[model samples]
Target chain A: MSIPGIRDRKIEDVGLQAGVDRLTEDQIQKTIKKVLKGETGAKLKLYAETCMRCGLCAEGCHYYMSHDKDPSYAPVSKVRQTMWEILRHNGKVSPEFIYGCAQIAYTECNMCKRCAHYCPLGIDIGYIISVVRRICHKLGVVPLYIQDTAHSHSATMNQMWVKDDEWPDALQWQEDEARDEIPNLRIPLEVEGADIFYSVIGPEPKFRTQLIYQAAVLMNETGQSWTMPATPGWDNSDMAMYTGDYEVMGRIKRAHFDTAMRLKVKRIVMGECGHAFRSIYDMGNRWLGWKMHPVRVMHAIEFYHELLEKGQLKIAKTFDTPVTLHDPCNIIRGRGLMDQAREVVKAFCPNFVEMTPNREHNYCCCAGGGVINCGPPFKNVRVEGNKVKAEQLIRTGVPVVIAPCHNCHGGLEDIIHAYKTGQELKFLIDIIYECMEKPDAVE
Target chain B: MNAAYEFVVGPLAWIAGAIFVLGSIYRLVSMYALAVKKDYSSLPYMDLKYSLRSIIHWLNPFGTAGWKASPWTAAVTFIFHICLIITPLFLLGHAVLLETFHGIEWPTISDGLADGLTMLVIAGCIFFIIRRATVDKLKYITSGMDWFVIFLVLATFLTGFAAYHQWLNYQFILILHILAGEAMLASIPFTRLSHMIFWVFIRGYMGSEFGKVRHAKDW
Candidate 1:
């Protein structure tokens, strides 16, 4: 039996609902108008017109190489197909163009901004793609599951429809479970005026709550002043941002920042996430019209570096397993945190091998940039699109892979399993806490 | 000069220039038609406030305006591209042509700059090709057409520099040089290379549309 047949065996394979899946030419034009209207505002014009396609960006893209060197896979070409065509034709392009734009913006590409590293002109192709996604979202042509996740972001302030009470309850539950590893661990919720506000996405409450517990254990053991919110603002992850639902994205970002402000924290120390960091640092903060983020946001990698650098967190034992780091584009390329992450890894693990072209030039997990969340129908493209990443992992010859960002971790897992890389993937926080001494175990 | 060389170099140059102009006009006109049909409007100035504020971004050491999207890659790639463009146009043979036609002589660079630029272009191309081959998502986007273009460029640059060195010591090397340069010009309008010129207009139009959408202008 073929791979599709095997996949079909796992689920009832009703194909995509026909007719409704495609948009009409007239509808596409209408969507273009609506998108233009919605996207109309201050600060977007600079974003729209700044691209210079030197193709220096070819180096940062995974899809471009993954799909047999299709120029359409290049981030610049993706923009060309949608925004460039719109400019060339002045918006008379068909709905099919919009459909293509939807796929390129939402599914085909991950808005990782790694290409930005190669672009001499520094055209934020990822930003341009996200804008295209925002337009597609307003046009009502986004893939169903991703759009549904965005709806959850709007309604519940979380992507998984996790309620407010469930958020705190999940964190408390994780704290309880962590006590087995280290006795008397407390995952404090809603503490006011804390120095650090640790924010996580909805998955912690919905599926991986133990991560929240792990984070709590690490935070407390490091003796950091941190707190998790007990309200709708707890989730810093924004699927709405990925799905191009700008209005909802604005809401989520606003709530997140407001919650941080309400707590009067020095900065937001986010859990292991890439898109969420991109949202807070790159997208969401900009949507709120701030020149710089009102609340300083740090990924878990940055926070860990800070803790270790200040000698606030001490590693009692070095993790003995050989490991490779999957550089999260947002943290590495966007924020220049790759060196810091490596420093943290070196402090925790005795055996660490750098992936080829690690740091700013790292390959995307192929699932990120909104590709993984696009829906199951596109899974074939997502998995097959990352064969090169699998090959890279195979070459590393390491048993453990540390992916700091949640989205990258999820996406990497899918690719690893699909290609059977036979490696265990863990969050940076997981390994950090595991290797650190308990508060009482200190010398 | 022999009439054949004159015809090939002069009239061919004219034809290449004409084709380049005509092809560019056609692409721009078609693009404009599409934008107009879509009611594409130039973004108002207020929307591009950041782009406006950073006027010197384009003139920076590494094309800072473009690099705002990506600083590190932009710096290195920009430097390499500069060498790629400058080395070809400023080669000794190119200087001879300019001295013959335009009556101007640029100060000759030490062989260091010449060889350095050649190596830079080679390295840049190699880096790009390796990236296209190694990265998964990028591999998906790497089509045969793109590879052909890059490979042709690599061959052109490599062979041109080799011919300059007179390594092969063959008349065919000069012919190859002229042929590659002419072929690159001819291919520009039809291939993705058209993106070089079209992107400006497209970017402007996109900036304007985003302005209209964002209710601001000047991006």
Candidate 2:
């Protein structure tokens, strides 16, 4: 029932102790209390008291079903570990308990909020867990690797430590690279008042710069009025979502919005990222006390759908494969965009297999909500824990898995690789790039 | 020892003690059986890693991790719960009843701890109510059931304190407080308070699931 490639490496054994050197119990307690007293703490209190324990959330959770019908792995149990225990004990539990709470709050759960979809009562266990993370961040119990990313986010406004001077250079690099495939391709940087404010996570600049290159080629072919940011706010990836550091999470979001506002763009068009979308819409913006976002946000899938539907982008060829889509919890469950993503998929791929309980009910990639970002020590558990997801994919027997969110893409890469399911994970744009009928071919 | 002639004391004592024991046993039995049927699994080894992280988590209790998760909310909410728990079992009335019935007069906390725990319960309830009102994300999630639970707790705490302090001679307040206490205990087997007994198992189960994912036993 498990994937062969999944390694049993324990994240704790992998130098997590190095991050443990600086922290002390008193400092962690102080940090935990501070976060609880802040806006995030208040949110946790509200979510905890509201859950009626209806167990409707069971079906929405992959872990719950993945473990052969264990009711405890249900998403609600995830909240119970952190919030309910804190509620029952009056904050007097030992540090060992807090550690368990930290892992459950941050790594084990993906904060996809799909369970909220299944709940008639609309209980958001993901929000409850994020609040737990907010508390954990304050306590300094966060895994060191993930914490470093947050530090990078705070310092560079990107998670991957991409240097300031390197951003525009990278964009130029991608544009130059893209010209090999499309001679007229360009990656527009800092074009004020452009119709689209194109944003991406630090991974784009750091590791998968080719995605940027691909986007540039697509944008060039479509002649889209897109602009990339030259400044610190260019990164749409918010590590605050993972750290549970709501205050920092809020600041990052405000920075992102202010950056967009300064540019006077109509709306932000983000690359494939689920958690970033959630941070902007669900966790961060709400922490800032806004009922709704003033500036609109669009996922890459929805944005591509608009472009294709409006004749802004043209297809080169129909992707001929039995490709299954892994709905990023942020986009599908958090934002309710299952149909649009499917529509975009149908337009490109000739054969699409829908996973059971597809769309908004899709399971998290086990890498989101900062879980994958939590570091390599906990990687084995994350991979092993996603047996249900692997099974879901295996049952579908699809050769390709398209995950539009960056975290999902990263996490899925690990999951698919670990399971050795021979499944190729991809961003929807990759398919669009391959399947879109060339302009010359159409002529 | 002189129980044969004293009908009210001996027979009623036996009845109350029996109900207390049998009812609690029944509740525990039913919960355990339900849990067994549902197959509440054990935590895996990865949970141990999480537990190990607690060494560092406890290092900075004031930071986010220490205070963010359950036991904190549970701590406050349960402070109220613990007060409700201790007060009912060790109150002057309960002491007198137990002395007459079960023949056990438990040593009590200082009057200060008693009153402090009560005030603590009140503060916890107030904190919960205010949080529901103020936080926008929380406000959307709050239900009428939540409000009812809050108000019910306030009534129980306020009335019990009033009776305990002798500020209310209105047998009404004392009687209502007693009824609420009894009702709450009975409801424990059915309502959300059941989470008190079940969350440990649930959390342990959740903790273990990660191990299966990690390909190790739960921490």
Candidate 3:
């Protein structure tokens, strides 16, 4: 059965056209059986048995609420279609069923775990959907684009596949841009024993090179000792973690941590990305058998919080434009940085108005959980599924929306365009860069 | 006592109690035995005081943060859980039975209070049944097992109410009440009613993980 609401957009855009063509029925069954029987344990059994199917969790799901209360979009329904089906069928489900499971688990649900908060039983539906993704990944039937990104992590140790030479070149280019202002600024490369090793996602170099320049100017103005590795591990983003490619996820996280260890930095401070922070601190590190990161890892929000609290960075002027904050699920809900994020935003923007449901209770931007990585074939679903978020943003009546996470930036951009909300989206750093008083300017 | 009454409230009662105790223990042990992945990330903050506080915060349906999300459902469900527990443990009839069985008696609510509590439980069950039957989202996820448990609780309460007022054949209704109550007990560890035992572990884990590891106020 064809997935409902999937437009005729290019499957090639998602990287699924080539990778999923060779999947056979026998392979699908065997892989599903192997994963469910081998990977799962009593926790899965307990959740399946304990859920009362009360559907009070329906309110917690943005997809279900946005889709006019469509039952299929409910968190439990997502699991019922995927993991519950696998268990009921004893993993002998047909390829068509697997195809549907892939779409529901990957494209339909964001795996944000918001519903788990509403769940009286506290069944982590996100974990259950991820188990389905793992089964699909083992069967080699993942969506095109995300799987391609996973393959990129496997082959290049970074999602963007930035060549070894290109990595340093990008850093040098950013350094040149920062030098134009400071005249003595340097994007410290591989500086051993640095106080901080700054990492960013792949898109930082690929598309948003100016963010690097902005971060460099901030680092230089603060007079903090920091280094950016001109190597494979500089990109902390891991799409493989979302694709259920544990081996690749483990390798990516190991490379990230090992790079920090190599630089001998006291800590690793990552840029404004939610999933990457979750990857290193919550998911990937544990998968690699480290209960915690060997070096302390802090999101840019926390780093900025410390800076402002310590009088390291001063606000020249608060942004006068009415603005609102969009909390990324990984950072706000997955981690507990909502207050710190708000503190940082409040420092720069005086006209800060909160979205109706702010902080940990905020709706996901629909681009997360690798949903945006599924690419254009699923774009309509992503936009329509997050219509509630778009409405929330529109209701805020703020001229600008501050989205701290990269995926939220991308996802909200789409929602603004699709909904014609005429709202501008900005990263917290963008506003900080615009409003902060540079120390060098004092001279 | 008649043969049927003797059988229903005697050996069957002992068997039901045994199953309730052993079954609960077995399920709890099996669940606790499952290996939870250790959180390796060094906590930025740890507050055991707040973790314990979160349990009370979340359990309060009217005052908790989650209450705002689904006020009606939370209110109804909260009342149902309270009545379900209190009516069974502190009701005058159940206390009398306990005294007769083990020669031990605890404080019991007045007969009027017991009747009122039983009425509330029955009303709560009816509200849930209508919700499961009518609400679009709830109807989609509602399973036969869910309805079965609701009706089972309803039957236990309805029969107990009838036996209390002597509205029906007293011995027969009493026997049915004992059977229904016992069946509900036996099903608790195996069915969705297992939440009765697992809620502590699940909510506690969420509290500690969110409160201590993430240093976030979940409530």
Q: Give me the candidate number with maximum TM-score.
A: 3
Full-model lDDT for every candidate: 0.70, 0.66, 0.82
Instruction: Estimate the TM-score for candidate 3.
Output: 0.94
For model 3 the local lDDT of residue B92 reads: 77
* TM of each candidate vs. truth: 0.68, 0.65, 0.94
Predicted candidate 3 versus true structure: per-residue lDDT over A70-121, tens digit per residue:
8878898777667776786677776656667777778888877777567766
Q: Which ranges of candidate 2 are over 4 A from the true structure? A: A1-33, A40-59, A69-72, A117-121, A438-443, B1-219
Clashing pairs in 3: A14-A144, A14-A145, A15-A144, A15-A145, A16-A144, A291-B40, A291-B41, A292-B40, A292-B41
Q: What ranking emerges by TM-score with the best candidate at the front?
A: 3, 1, 2
Q: Candidate 3 — which residues are off by over 4 angstroms?
A: A1-29, A441-443, B36-51
Q: Score the docking of each candidate (DockQ).
A: 0.07, 0.03, 0.42
lDDT of 1 by residue, B100-152 (tens): 97899875666667878888887777867786687543554345556766776
Ranking by lDDT: 3, 1, 2
Clashes of each: 60, 80, 9
Of the two candidates 2 and 3, the one with more favorable lDDT, higher being better, is: 3
